[model samples]
Target: MNKLLIFDLDDTIFETKSIKKESVKPIFDQLEPLLINKFGTALTAQIIPELWKYPFDFVAEKYKFDKHQNTEFARFINEHEYKLNIRTFDDFSVVENLKQEKILVTTGFSKLQHAKIHYLGIKQKFSEVYIDNILSSERVFKKGIFQSILLERKIEPQLVYIIGDNPNSELKAGFELGLHTVQVAKFGQEKSDYANYCISNFNELIPILK
Candidate 1:
Protein backbone atom coordinates (compact mmCIF):
# COMPACT_ATOMS: atom_id res chain seq x y z
CA MET A 1 0.00 0.00 0.00
CA ASN A 2 1.21 3.50 -0.73
CA LYS A 3 1.75 5.57 2.40
CA LEU A 4 0.95 9.27 2.79
CA LEU A 5 2.37 11.63 5.39
CA ILE A 6 0.60 14.81 6.42
CA PHE A 7 2.56 17.47 8.30
CA ASP A 8 1.84 20.59 10.33
CA LEU A 9 3.94 23.67 9.74
CA ASP A 10 4.58 25.65 12.91
CA ASP A 11 5.84 23.59 15.84
CA THR A 12 5.93 20.36 13.86
CA ILE A 13 8.43 21.19 11.10
CA PHE A 14 9.89 24.39 12.49
CA GLU A 15 9.96 26.17 15.83
CA THR A 16 7.73 29.23 15.86
CA LYS A 17 9.52 30.10 19.11
CA SER A 18 12.48 30.95 16.91
CA ILE A 19 10.44 34.00 16.00
CA LYS A 20 11.55 36.44 18.64
CA LYS A 21 8.64 37.95 20.60
CA GLU A 22 10.10 41.39 20.06
CA SER A 23 10.25 40.76 16.30
CA VAL A 24 6.46 40.40 16.27
CA LYS A 25 5.86 42.94 19.05
CA PRO A 26 5.48 45.82 16.63
CA ILE A 27 2.47 44.23 14.98
CA PHE A 28 0.93 43.45 18.38
CA ASP A 29 1.66 46.98 19.45
CA GLN A 30 -0.64 48.17 16.71
CA LEU A 31 -3.29 45.68 17.85
CA GLU A 32 -3.10 46.21 21.65
CA PRO A 33 -5.24 49.31 21.85
CA LEU A 34 -8.05 47.66 19.95
CA LEU A 35 -7.94 44.50 22.06
CA ILE A 36 -7.65 46.45 25.27
CA ASN A 37 -10.64 48.54 24.41
CA LYS A 38 -12.82 45.48 23.87
CA PHE A 39 -11.50 43.05 26.49
CA GLY A 40 -9.90 45.38 29.00
CA THR A 41 -6.21 45.53 30.02
CA ALA A 42 -5.86 42.33 32.05
CA LEU A 43 -7.65 40.05 29.58
CA THR A 44 -5.97 41.64 26.60
CA ALA A 45 -2.61 41.15 28.31
CA GLN A 46 -3.40 37.45 28.76
CA ILE A 47 -4.55 37.07 25.17
CA ILE A 48 -1.34 38.50 23.72
CA PRO A 49 0.85 35.49 24.61
CA GLU A 50 -1.81 33.10 23.34
CA LEU A 51 -2.00 35.05 20.08
CA TRP A 52 1.65 34.22 19.62
CA LYS A 53 1.10 30.55 20.39
CA TYR A 54 -2.20 29.69 18.65
CA PRO A 55 -4.17 30.55 15.51
CA PHE A 56 -6.33 33.65 15.74
CA ASP A 57 -9.65 31.79 15.62
CA PHE A 58 -8.78 29.64 18.62
CA VAL A 59 -7.50 32.62 20.54
CA ALA A 60 -10.51 34.74 19.62
CA GLU A 61 -12.99 32.09 20.73
CA LYS A 62 -11.13 31.31 23.95
CA TYR A 63 -11.10 34.97 24.92
CA LYS A 64 -14.65 35.69 23.75
CA PHE A 65 -13.52 38.24 21.19
CA ASP A 66 -16.38 39.98 19.40
CA LYS A 67 -16.76 40.17 15.62
CA HIS A 68 -15.23 43.61 15.39
CA GLN A 69 -12.25 42.52 17.51
CA ASN A 70 -11.72 39.47 15.33
CA THR A 71 -11.79 41.63 12.23
CA GLU A 72 -9.29 44.09 13.66
CA PHE A 73 -6.97 41.35 14.90
CA ALA A 74 -7.01 39.63 11.52
CA ARG A 75 -6.36 42.90 9.80
CA PHE A 76 -3.16 43.47 11.76
CA ILE A 77 -1.89 39.88 11.77
CA ASN A 78 -2.74 38.87 8.21
CA GLU A 79 -1.15 41.93 6.69
CA HIS A 80 2.14 41.61 8.59
CA GLU A 81 4.89 39.26 7.37
CA TYR A 82 8.03 38.13 9.05
CA LYS A 83 10.90 39.88 7.31
CA LEU A 84 13.59 37.69 8.96
CA ASN A 85 14.60 34.26 7.76
CA ILE A 86 12.77 31.47 9.56
CA ARG A 87 14.62 28.30 10.50
CA THR A 88 13.39 24.75 10.87
CA PHE A 89 14.45 22.32 13.56
CA ASP A 90 17.91 20.76 13.15
CA ASP A 91 16.47 17.25 12.77
CA PHE A 92 14.07 18.40 10.04
CA SER A 93 16.51 17.08 7.45
CA VAL A 94 15.31 13.61 8.41
CA VAL A 95 11.90 14.67 7.18
CA GLU A 96 13.52 16.23 4.10
CA ASN A 97 15.08 12.87 3.22
CA LEU A 98 11.93 10.83 3.78
CA LYS A 99 10.62 9.24 0.60
CA GLN A 100 6.93 9.02 1.51
CA GLU A 101 4.49 11.30 -0.33
CA LYS A 102 4.19 14.30 2.03
CA ILE A 103 1.57 16.99 2.42
CA LEU A 104 1.74 20.08 4.63
CA VAL A 105 -1.47 21.26 6.32
CA THR A 106 -1.11 24.20 8.62
CA THR A 107 -3.56 26.63 10.24
CA GLY A 108 -2.96 30.36 10.58
CA PHE A 109 -3.53 33.74 9.05
CA SER A 110 -2.87 33.42 5.32
CA LYS A 111 -0.09 35.87 4.65
CA LEU A 112 1.91 35.11 7.83
CA GLN A 113 1.77 31.36 7.18
CA HIS A 114 2.79 31.84 3.55
CA ALA A 115 5.62 34.12 4.64
CA LYS A 116 7.06 31.43 6.93
CA ILE A 117 6.86 28.85 4.18
CA HIS A 118 8.60 31.24 1.80
CA TYR A 119 11.34 32.07 4.30
CA LEU A 120 11.96 28.40 5.14
CA GLY A 121 12.42 27.65 1.42
CA ILE A 122 11.01 24.17 1.89
CA LYS A 123 7.98 24.60 -0.34
CA GLN A 124 9.19 22.10 -2.92
CA LYS A 125 9.68 19.52 -0.19
CA PHE A 126 5.96 18.78 0.05
CA SER A 127 3.67 17.39 -2.64
CA GLU A 128 1.17 20.09 -1.69
CA VAL A 129 0.84 22.77 1.00
CA TYR A 130 -2.44 23.76 2.60
CA ILE A 131 -3.15 26.63 4.90
CA ASP A 132 -6.35 26.67 6.96
CA ASN A 133 -6.87 30.38 6.72
CA ILE A 134 -8.61 31.62 9.89
CA LEU A 135 -9.47 34.89 8.18
CA SER A 136 -11.53 33.15 5.49
CA SER A 137 -15.32 33.48 5.58
CA GLU A 138 -15.64 29.73 5.69
CA ARG A 139 -12.74 28.07 7.43
CA VAL A 140 -12.28 24.35 7.08
CA PHE A 141 -10.09 23.29 9.96
CA LYS A 142 -7.42 20.61 9.53
CA LYS A 143 -9.89 17.72 9.93
CA GLY A 144 -12.05 18.78 6.98
CA ILE A 145 -9.02 19.20 4.78
CA PHE A 146 -7.61 15.84 5.89
CA GLN A 147 -10.91 14.11 5.20
CA SER A 148 -11.16 15.75 1.78
CA ILE A 149 -7.66 14.59 0.90
CA LEU A 150 -8.58 11.03 1.87
CA LEU A 151 -11.78 11.13 -0.20
CA GLU A 152 -10.26 12.91 -3.21
CA ARG A 153 -7.21 10.67 -3.30
CA LYS A 154 -9.25 7.54 -2.48
CA ILE A 155 -6.79 6.74 0.28
CA GLU A 156 -7.47 4.26 3.03
CA PRO A 157 -7.06 5.50 6.57
CA GLN A 158 -4.40 2.89 7.39
CA LEU A 159 -2.18 4.18 4.61
CA VAL A 160 -2.21 7.71 6.01
CA TYR A 161 -0.28 9.33 8.86
CA ILE A 162 -0.87 12.69 10.51
CA ILE A 163 2.05 14.36 12.27
CA GLY A 164 1.77 17.53 14.32
CA ASP A 165 2.38 19.05 17.76
CA ASN A 166 -1.13 20.05 18.76
CA PRO A 167 -3.17 17.30 20.38
CA ASN A 168 -6.44 19.18 19.94
CA SER A 169 -5.83 19.96 16.28
CA GLU A 170 -4.21 17.65 13.72
CA LEU A 171 -3.55 14.78 16.09
CA LYS A 172 -7.19 14.60 17.19
CA ALA A 173 -8.43 15.07 13.64
CA GLY A 174 -6.30 12.25 12.32
CA PHE A 175 -7.36 10.01 15.18
CA GLU A 176 -11.05 10.63 14.44
CA LEU A 177 -10.49 9.76 10.78
CA GLY A 178 -8.69 6.51 11.75
CA LEU A 179 -5.37 7.68 10.35
CA HIS A 180 -2.15 7.05 12.24
CA THR A 181 -1.30 9.90 14.59
CA VAL A 182 2.24 10.89 15.48
CA GLN A 183 2.92 13.68 17.91
CA VAL A 184 6.11 15.63 17.34
CA ALA A 185 7.13 16.69 20.83
CA LYS A 186 10.06 18.86 19.86
CA PHE A 187 9.89 20.87 23.05
CA GLY A 188 9.50 17.85 25.35
CA GLN A 189 5.72 17.94 25.35
CA GLU A 190 4.01 15.06 27.12
CA LYS A 191 2.45 12.30 25.06
CA SER A 192 -1.20 12.77 24.22
CA ASP A 193 -3.68 9.90 24.61
CA TYR A 194 -4.59 10.32 20.95
CA ALA A 195 -1.15 9.69 19.46
CA ASN A 196 -0.25 6.28 18.09
CA TYR A 197 3.36 7.37 18.41
CA CYS A 198 5.20 10.13 20.23
CA ILE A 199 8.46 11.16 18.68
CA SER A 200 10.78 14.10 19.17
CA ASN A 201 12.90 13.52 16.11
CA PHE A 202 11.83 12.78 12.59
CA ASN A 203 14.37 9.94 12.49
CA GLU A 204 12.21 8.10 15.01
CA LEU A 205 9.54 7.96 12.32
CA ILE A 206 11.64 5.43 10.38
CA PRO A 207 10.91 2.67 12.87
CA ILE A 208 7.25 3.64 13.19
CA LEU A 209 6.77 3.98 9.45
CA LYS A 210 8.35 0.61 8.92
Candidate 2:
Protein backbone atom coordinates (compact mmCIF):
# COMPACT_ATOMS: atom_id res chain seq x y z
CA MET A 1 0.00 0.00 0.00
CA ASN A 2 1.09 3.61 -0.53
CA LYS A 3 2.40 5.44 2.53
CA LEU A 4 1.46 8.84 4.04
CA LEU A 5 3.59 11.05 6.32
CA ILE A 6 1.99 13.57 8.66
CA PHE A 7 4.24 16.21 10.27
CA ASP A 8 3.69 18.75 13.03
CA LEU A 9 4.52 22.32 12.02
CA ASP A 10 5.79 24.13 15.09
CA ASP A 11 8.75 22.25 16.55
CA THR A 12 8.74 19.65 13.80
CA ILE A 13 9.21 21.63 10.61
CA PHE A 14 10.27 24.93 12.17
CA GLU A 15 11.57 25.79 15.64
CA THR A 16 8.42 27.37 17.03
CA LYS A 17 9.88 28.21 20.42
CA SER A 18 12.76 30.09 18.85
CA ILE A 19 10.44 32.17 16.70
CA LYS A 20 8.29 33.00 19.72
CA LYS A 21 11.29 33.96 21.80
CA GLU A 22 13.06 36.11 19.24
CA SER A 23 10.37 37.53 17.04
CA VAL A 24 7.02 37.47 18.83
CA LYS A 25 8.37 38.29 22.27
CA PRO A 26 9.96 41.54 21.11
CA ILE A 27 6.69 42.71 19.67
CA PHE A 28 5.07 41.91 22.98
CA ASP A 29 7.78 43.86 24.73
CA GLN A 30 7.02 46.89 22.58
CA LEU A 31 3.35 46.40 23.20
CA GLU A 32 3.97 46.26 26.95
CA PRO A 33 4.28 50.03 27.32
CA LEU A 34 1.33 50.57 25.05
CA LEU A 35 -0.72 48.15 27.10
CA ILE A 36 0.38 49.83 30.31
CA ASN A 37 -0.70 53.18 28.96
CA LYS A 38 -4.02 51.68 27.96
CA PHE A 39 -4.69 49.34 30.91
CA GLY A 40 -2.23 50.48 33.63
CA THR A 41 -0.64 48.16 36.27
CA ALA A 42 -2.88 45.26 35.38
CA LEU A 43 -1.25 45.22 31.94
CA THR A 44 2.12 43.68 32.86
CA ALA A 45 1.07 40.26 34.05
CA GLN A 46 -1.94 39.86 31.83
CA ILE A 47 -0.10 41.00 28.72
CA ILE A 48 2.69 38.45 29.10
CA PRO A 49 0.72 35.24 28.66
CA GLU A 50 -2.04 36.95 26.79
CA LEU A 51 0.32 37.75 23.94
CA TRP A 52 0.86 34.05 23.55
CA LYS A 53 -2.74 32.82 23.71
CA TYR A 54 -4.05 34.16 20.45
CA PRO A 55 -1.16 36.65 20.25
CA PHE A 56 -2.52 39.13 17.74
CA ASP A 57 -6.26 39.25 18.21
CA PHE A 58 -6.11 38.76 21.96
CA VAL A 59 -4.09 41.96 22.30
CA ALA A 60 -6.33 43.81 19.92
CA GLU A 61 -9.50 42.89 21.75
CA LYS A 62 -8.07 43.55 25.22
CA TYR A 63 -6.82 47.04 24.35
CA LYS A 64 -9.63 48.02 22.01
CA PHE A 65 -6.87 49.03 19.62
CA ASP A 66 -8.07 50.38 16.30
CA LYS A 67 -7.55 48.74 12.94
CA HIS A 68 -4.40 50.76 12.40
CA GLN A 69 -2.82 49.37 15.54
CA ASN A 70 -3.98 45.89 14.65
CA THR A 71 -2.64 46.19 11.14
CA GLU A 72 0.65 47.57 12.46
CA PHE A 73 0.97 44.69 14.92
CA ALA A 74 0.26 42.18 12.22
CA ARG A 75 2.79 43.85 9.94
CA PHE A 76 5.44 43.82 12.67
CA ILE A 77 4.75 40.18 13.40
CA ASN A 78 4.68 39.15 9.77
CA GLU A 79 7.93 40.97 9.12
CA HIS A 80 9.80 39.16 11.85
CA GLU A 81 7.51 36.14 12.10
CA TYR A 82 10.14 33.69 10.85
CA LYS A 83 13.89 33.95 11.41
CA LEU A 84 14.64 30.74 9.44
CA ASN A 85 17.87 30.21 11.38
CA ILE A 86 17.34 26.48 11.83
CA ARG A 87 17.08 24.07 8.92
CA THR A 88 14.12 21.79 8.47
CA PHE A 89 15.06 18.30 9.74
CA ASP A 90 14.43 16.76 6.37
CA ASP A 91 15.55 20.01 4.85
CA PHE A 92 13.98 20.50 1.44
CA SER A 93 15.04 16.98 0.55
CA VAL A 94 12.68 15.17 2.91
CA VAL A 95 9.54 16.57 1.36
CA GLU A 96 10.91 16.03 -2.13
CA ASN A 97 11.90 12.47 -1.27
CA LEU A 98 8.51 11.75 0.28
CA LYS A 99 6.66 13.18 -2.71
CA GLN A 100 7.74 10.15 -4.66
CA GLU A 101 6.03 7.78 -2.22
CA LYS A 102 3.67 9.43 0.28
CA ILE A 103 1.43 12.29 1.31
CA LEU A 104 2.19 14.80 4.12
CA VAL A 105 -0.24 15.89 6.85
CA THR A 106 -0.17 18.90 9.18
CA THR A 107 -2.68 20.95 11.19
CA GLY A 108 -2.57 24.61 12.24
CA PHE A 109 -4.32 27.97 11.82
CA SER A 110 -4.45 28.75 8.12
CA LYS A 111 -2.72 32.15 8.07
CA LEU A 112 -0.07 31.28 10.61
CA GLN A 113 0.84 27.97 8.98
CA HIS A 114 0.59 29.42 5.51
CA ALA A 115 3.02 32.24 6.31
CA LYS A 116 5.64 29.85 7.61
CA ILE A 117 5.13 27.46 4.72
CA HIS A 118 5.45 30.28 2.23
CA TYR A 119 8.51 31.75 3.99
CA LEU A 120 10.12 28.32 3.92
CA GLY A 121 8.87 27.87 0.35
CA ILE A 122 7.81 24.28 1.00
CA LYS A 123 4.08 24.72 0.50
CA GLN A 124 4.07 22.50 -2.55
CA LYS A 125 5.92 19.72 -0.76
CA PHE A 126 2.83 18.49 1.04
CA SER A 127 0.14 16.54 -0.75
CA GLU A 128 -2.30 18.01 1.79
CA VAL A 129 -2.28 20.74 4.40
CA TYR A 130 -4.88 20.40 7.18
CA ILE A 131 -5.12 23.77 8.87
CA ASP A 132 -7.23 23.96 12.03
CA ASN A 133 -9.84 26.21 10.39
CA ILE A 134 -10.65 23.45 7.94
CA LEU A 135 -11.41 21.09 10.78
CA SER A 136 -14.86 20.75 12.37
CA SER A 137 -13.78 22.37 15.63
CA GLU A 138 -11.25 24.85 17.06
CA ARG A 139 -9.71 22.77 19.83
CA VAL A 140 -5.93 22.34 20.17
CA PHE A 141 -6.00 18.61 20.88
CA LYS A 142 -6.66 17.74 17.27
CA LYS A 143 -6.74 13.97 17.16
CA GLY A 144 -10.26 13.94 15.89
CA ILE A 145 -9.27 16.33 13.12
CA PHE A 146 -6.40 14.05 12.14
CA GLN A 147 -8.70 11.08 12.00
CA SER A 148 -11.10 13.03 9.87
CA ILE A 149 -8.33 13.73 7.37
CA LEU A 150 -7.64 10.04 6.94
CA LEU A 151 -11.32 9.13 6.55
CA GLU A 152 -12.08 12.08 4.31
CA ARG A 153 -9.13 11.35 2.06
CA LYS A 154 -9.90 7.62 2.01
CA ILE A 155 -6.35 6.78 3.09
CA GLU A 156 -5.56 3.50 4.80
CA PRO A 157 -4.52 3.47 8.45
CA GLN A 158 -1.38 1.40 7.95
CA LEU A 159 -0.16 3.65 5.17
CA VAL A 160 -0.19 6.75 7.39
CA TYR A 161 2.55 7.83 9.83
CA ILE A 162 2.64 10.80 12.21
CA ILE A 163 5.95 12.52 12.97
CA GLY A 164 6.09 15.11 15.74
CA ASP A 165 7.78 16.35 18.92
CA ASN A 166 5.10 15.94 21.59
CA PRO A 167 4.00 12.33 21.29
CA ASN A 168 1.23 12.28 23.87
CA SER A 169 -1.60 13.66 21.78
CA GLU A 170 -0.36 13.05 18.25
CA LEU A 171 1.02 9.61 19.01
CA LYS A 172 -2.07 8.64 20.92
CA ALA A 173 -4.21 9.70 18.00
CA GLY A 174 -2.05 7.88 15.47
CA PHE A 175 -1.74 4.70 17.53
CA GLU A 176 -5.42 4.62 18.39
CA LEU A 177 -6.25 5.04 14.73
CA GLY A 178 -3.71 2.33 13.76
CA LEU A 179 -1.04 4.45 12.08
CA HIS A 180 2.74 4.33 12.62
CA THR A 181 4.25 6.97 14.91
CA VAL A 182 7.64 8.69 15.22
CA GLN A 183 8.63 11.23 17.86
CA VAL A 184 11.35 13.86 17.43
CA ALA A 185 12.47 15.43 20.67
CA LYS A 186 12.24 19.16 21.28
CA PHE A 187 15.34 21.12 22.37
CA GLY A 188 14.93 20.75 26.15
CA GLN A 189 12.32 18.01 26.35
CA GLU A 190 13.13 14.59 27.82
CA LYS A 191 11.83 11.36 26.34
CA SER A 192 8.17 10.57 26.85
CA ASP A 193 5.81 7.69 26.34
CA TYR A 194 3.31 7.34 23.43
CA ALA A 195 5.79 7.29 20.58
CA ASN A 196 6.55 3.96 18.95
CA TYR A 197 9.97 5.37 17.99
CA CYS A 198 11.77 8.37 19.46
CA ILE A 199 14.80 10.21 18.12
CA SER A 200 16.55 13.46 19.00
CA ASN A 201 17.32 14.47 15.46
CA PHE A 202 15.68 14.34 12.07
CA ASN A 203 18.67 12.56 10.47
CA GLU A 204 17.89 9.60 12.70
CA LEU A 205 14.56 9.23 10.92
CA ILE A 206 15.89 8.08 7.51
CA PRO A 207 16.48 4.49 8.54
CA ILE A 208 13.15 4.21 10.35
CA LEU A 209 11.30 5.44 7.28
CA LYS A 210 12.65 2.46 5.36
Candidate 3:
Protein backbone atom coordinates (compact mmCIF):
# COMPACT_ATOMS: atom_id res chain seq x y z
CA MET A 1 0.00 0.00 0.00
CA ASN A 2 1.25 3.51 -0.78
CA LYS A 3 1.35 6.15 1.92
CA LEU A 4 0.72 9.87 1.71
CA LEU A 5 3.69 12.16 2.38
CA ILE A 6 3.25 15.77 3.41
CA PHE A 7 6.35 17.98 3.25
CA ASP A 8 7.50 21.35 4.54
CA LEU A 9 9.47 23.36 1.97
CA ASP A 10 11.93 25.53 3.88
CA ASP A 11 14.84 23.86 5.65
CA THR A 12 13.29 20.49 4.91
CA ILE A 13 13.71 20.37 1.14
CA PHE A 14 16.37 23.12 0.98
CA GLU A 15 18.26 25.47 3.24
CA THR A 16 16.72 28.92 3.18
CA LYS A 17 19.84 30.21 4.93
CA SER A 18 22.00 28.94 2.09
CA ILE A 19 20.82 31.69 -0.21
CA LYS A 20 24.00 33.73 -0.74
CA LYS A 21 24.55 36.92 1.26
CA GLU A 22 24.54 39.02 -1.88
CA SER A 23 21.08 37.71 -2.84
CA VAL A 24 19.54 38.58 0.54
CA LYS A 25 21.50 41.73 1.44
CA PRO A 26 19.17 44.08 -0.35
CA ILE A 27 16.18 42.74 1.58
CA PHE A 28 17.93 43.22 4.90
CA ASP A 29 19.06 46.70 3.91
CA GLN A 30 15.47 47.67 3.15
CA LEU A 31 14.16 46.08 6.33
CA GLU A 32 16.82 47.49 8.64
CA PRO A 33 15.45 50.99 8.67
CA LEU A 34 11.87 49.80 9.12
CA LEU A 35 12.82 47.57 12.04
CA ILE A 36 14.96 50.27 13.58
CA ASN A 37 12.11 52.72 13.36
CA LYS A 38 9.65 50.44 15.10
CA PHE A 39 12.02 48.75 17.58
CA GLY A 40 14.96 51.18 17.71
CA THR A 41 18.62 50.32 17.12
CA ALA A 42 19.18 47.99 20.08
CA LEU A 43 16.15 45.74 19.57
CA THR A 44 16.51 45.83 15.79
CA ALA A 45 20.06 44.55 16.13
CA GLN A 46 18.81 41.51 18.03
CA ILE A 47 16.07 40.80 15.47
CA ILE A 48 18.31 40.78 12.38
CA PRO A 49 20.01 37.48 13.24
CA GLU A 50 16.66 35.76 13.68
CA LEU A 51 15.00 36.83 10.44
CA TRP A 52 16.56 33.98 8.50
CA LYS A 53 16.26 31.50 11.36
CA TYR A 54 12.47 31.64 11.59
CA PRO A 55 9.45 32.65 9.52
CA PHE A 56 8.93 36.40 9.27
CA ASP A 57 5.58 36.11 11.06
CA PHE A 58 7.17 34.21 13.92
CA VAL A 59 9.84 36.86 14.34
CA ALA A 60 7.32 39.65 14.03
CA GLU A 61 5.08 38.14 16.70
CA LYS A 62 8.02 37.48 19.02
CA TYR A 63 8.99 41.15 18.77
CA LYS A 64 5.44 42.42 19.37
CA PHE A 65 4.91 43.94 15.93
CA ASP A 66 1.67 45.93 15.69
CA LYS A 67 -0.82 45.79 12.80
CA HIS A 68 0.80 48.67 10.91
CA GLN A 69 4.29 47.23 11.30
CA ASN A 70 3.13 43.87 9.99
CA THR A 71 1.43 45.54 7.03
CA GLU A 72 4.57 47.42 6.07
CA PHE A 73 6.75 44.32 6.38
CA ALA A 74 4.32 42.31 4.27
CA ARG A 75 4.24 44.99 1.63
CA PHE A 76 8.01 44.92 1.21
CA ILE A 77 8.24 41.12 1.38
CA ASN A 78 5.56 40.62 -1.26
CA GLU A 79 7.38 43.02 -3.56
CA HIS A 80 10.74 41.27 -3.31
CA GLU A 81 11.73 38.32 -5.56
CA TYR A 82 14.65 35.95 -5.47
CA LYS A 83 17.27 36.86 -8.11
CA LEU A 84 19.12 33.55 -8.34
CA ASN A 85 17.93 29.96 -8.53
CA ILE A 86 17.62 27.98 -5.31
CA ARG A 87 18.90 24.43 -4.91
CA THR A 88 17.42 21.55 -2.97
CA PHE A 89 19.44 19.27 -0.71
CA ASP A 90 21.39 16.53 -2.51
CA ASP A 91 19.26 13.77 -0.99
CA PHE A 92 15.97 15.45 -1.92
CA SER A 93 15.70 13.27 -5.04
CA VAL A 94 14.90 10.30 -2.79
CA VAL A 95 11.68 12.00 -1.81
CA GLU A 96 11.04 13.40 -5.26
CA ASN A 97 11.29 10.05 -7.00
CA LEU A 98 9.24 8.12 -4.49
CA LYS A 99 6.06 6.59 -5.90
CA GLN A 100 3.87 7.56 -3.00
CA GLU A 101 1.67 10.61 -3.27
CA LYS A 102 3.28 13.83 -2.01
CA ILE A 103 2.12 17.28 -1.03
CA LEU A 104 3.89 20.52 -0.09
CA VAL A 105 2.59 22.69 2.72
CA THR A 106 4.64 25.69 3.77
CA THR A 107 4.21 28.99 5.57
CA GLY A 108 5.39 32.44 4.46
CA PHE A 109 4.48 35.42 2.35
CA SER A 110 2.86 33.90 -0.76
CA LYS A 111 5.02 35.67 -3.31
CA LEU A 112 8.35 34.91 -1.56
CA GLN A 113 7.46 31.26 -1.00
CA HIS A 114 6.21 30.86 -4.58
CA ALA A 115 9.39 32.47 -5.88
CA LYS A 116 11.50 29.93 -4.06
CA ILE A 117 9.36 27.14 -5.49
CA HIS A 118 9.71 28.59 -8.97
CA TYR A 119 13.49 28.86 -8.73
CA LEU A 120 13.86 25.37 -7.28
CA GLY A 121 11.79 23.98 -10.20
CA ILE A 122 9.88 21.46 -8.07
CA LYS A 123 6.38 22.84 -8.25
CA GLN A 124 5.17 20.06 -10.54
CA LYS A 125 6.55 17.31 -8.27
CA PHE A 126 3.83 17.64 -5.69
CA SER A 127 0.21 16.76 -6.31
CA GLU A 128 -0.72 19.80 -4.24
CA VAL A 129 1.13 22.85 -2.99
CA TYR A 130 -0.40 24.98 -0.30
CA ILE A 131 1.02 28.14 1.18
CA ASP A 132 -0.11 29.46 4.54
CA ASN A 133 0.32 33.14 3.85
CA ILE A 134 1.09 34.98 7.08
CA LEU A 135 -0.01 38.22 5.50
CA SER A 136 -3.46 36.88 4.69
CA SER A 137 -6.30 37.87 7.00
CA GLU A 138 -7.60 34.28 6.93
CA ARG A 139 -4.31 32.42 6.99
CA VAL A 140 -4.63 28.67 7.55
CA PHE A 141 -1.99 26.51 9.15
CA LYS A 142 -0.37 23.13 8.47
CA LYS A 143 -2.80 21.34 10.77
CA GLY A 144 -5.83 22.47 8.79
CA ILE A 145 -4.19 21.52 5.50
CA PHE A 146 -3.20 18.11 6.83
CA GLN A 147 -6.72 17.48 8.03
CA SER A 148 -8.13 18.45 4.67
CA ILE A 149 -5.78 16.06 2.88
CA LEU A 150 -6.84 13.21 5.11
CA LEU A 151 -10.52 13.96 4.64
CA GLU A 152 -10.39 14.59 0.93
CA ARG A 153 -8.36 11.50 0.18
CA LYS A 154 -10.19 9.39 2.75
CA ILE A 155 -6.91 8.06 4.11
CA GLU A 156 -6.31 6.78 7.59
CA PRO A 157 -4.03 8.91 9.75
CA GLN A 158 -1.69 5.92 10.14
CA LEU A 159 -1.17 5.80 6.37
CA VAL A 160 0.31 9.32 6.20
CA TYR A 161 3.57 10.87 7.34
CA ILE A 162 4.15 14.56 7.98
CA ILE A 163 7.77 15.47 7.12
CA GLY A 164 9.24 18.75 8.32
CA ASP A 165 12.00 20.28 10.47
CA ASN A 166 9.96 22.33 12.91
CA PRO A 167 8.58 20.82 16.12
CA ASN A 168 6.23 23.73 16.81
CA SER A 169 4.71 23.60 13.36
CA GLU A 170 4.20 20.42 11.27
CA LEU A 171 5.42 17.92 13.86
CA LYS A 172 3.07 19.19 16.52
CA ALA A 173 0.16 19.44 14.10
CA GLY A 174 0.72 15.95 12.69
CA PHE A 175 0.96 14.50 16.19
CA GLU A 176 -2.32 16.10 17.22
CA LEU A 177 -4.06 14.56 14.22
CA GLY A 178 -2.64 11.04 14.84
CA LEU A 179 -0.34 10.97 11.79
CA HIS A 180 3.27 9.81 11.80
CA THR A 181 5.69 12.75 12.11
CA VAL A 182 9.20 12.68 10.64
CA GLN A 183 11.62 15.48 11.45
CA VAL A 184 14.29 16.06 8.79
CA ALA A 185 17.33 17.21 10.77
CA LYS A 186 19.18 18.66 7.80
CA PHE A 187 21.49 20.97 9.79
CA GLY A 188 22.35 18.61 12.65
CA GLN A 189 19.20 19.83 14.28
CA GLU A 190 18.38 18.07 17.51
CA LYS A 191 15.64 15.46 17.35
CA SER A 192 12.26 16.64 18.55
CA ASP A 193 10.39 14.50 21.08
CA TYR A 194 7.26 14.94 18.98
CA ALA A 195 8.81 13.27 15.91
CA ASN A 196 8.16 9.57 15.42
CA TYR A 197 11.42 9.42 13.50
CA CYS A 198 14.28 11.86 12.82
CA ILE A 199 16.43 11.76 9.69
CA SER A 200 19.35 13.71 8.31
CA ASN A 201 18.40 12.90 4.72
CA PHE A 202 15.62 11.26 2.75
CA ASN A 203 17.63 8.02 2.34
CA GLU A 204 17.01 7.24 6.02
CA LEU A 205 13.27 7.38 5.46
CA ILE A 206 13.00 4.33 3.19
CA PRO A 207 12.95 1.80 6.03
CA ILE A 208 10.63 3.96 8.11
CA LEU A 209 8.21 4.44 5.24
CA LYS A 210 8.29 0.75 4.42
C-alpha TM-scores of all predictions: 0.95, 0.65, 0.94
Clashing residue pairs in candidate 1 (N, C-alpha, C atoms within 3 angstroms): none
Candidate 3: minimum summed lDDT over ten consecutive residues — where? Answer: 77-86
Global lDDT for candidate 2? 0.63
Models sorted by lDDT, best on top: 1, 3, 2
Query: Which residue runs does candidate 3 get wrong by more than 4 Å?
Result: none
- For each candidate in the order shown, give its overall lDDT on alpha carbons: 0.89, 0.63, 0.88
Candidate 1 or 3, higher lDDT?
A: 1
Ranking by TM-score: 1, 3, 2
Task: Report how far off residue 204 is in candidate 2 (Å).
Answer: 2.5
RMSD of each: 1.4, 5.7, 1.4
For candidate 2, the clash count comes to 0
Candidate 2 — worst ten consecutive residues by lDDT sum? 132-141
Stretches of candidate 1 exceeding 4 Å from the true structure: none
Candidate with better TM-score, 2 vs 3: 3
RMSD of 1: 1.4
How does candidate 1 score on lDDT? Answer: 0.89
Kindly list the per-residue Cα lDDT of model 2 for residues 13-61, writing each as its tens digit: 7665544366446666666665566568676577667667543444566
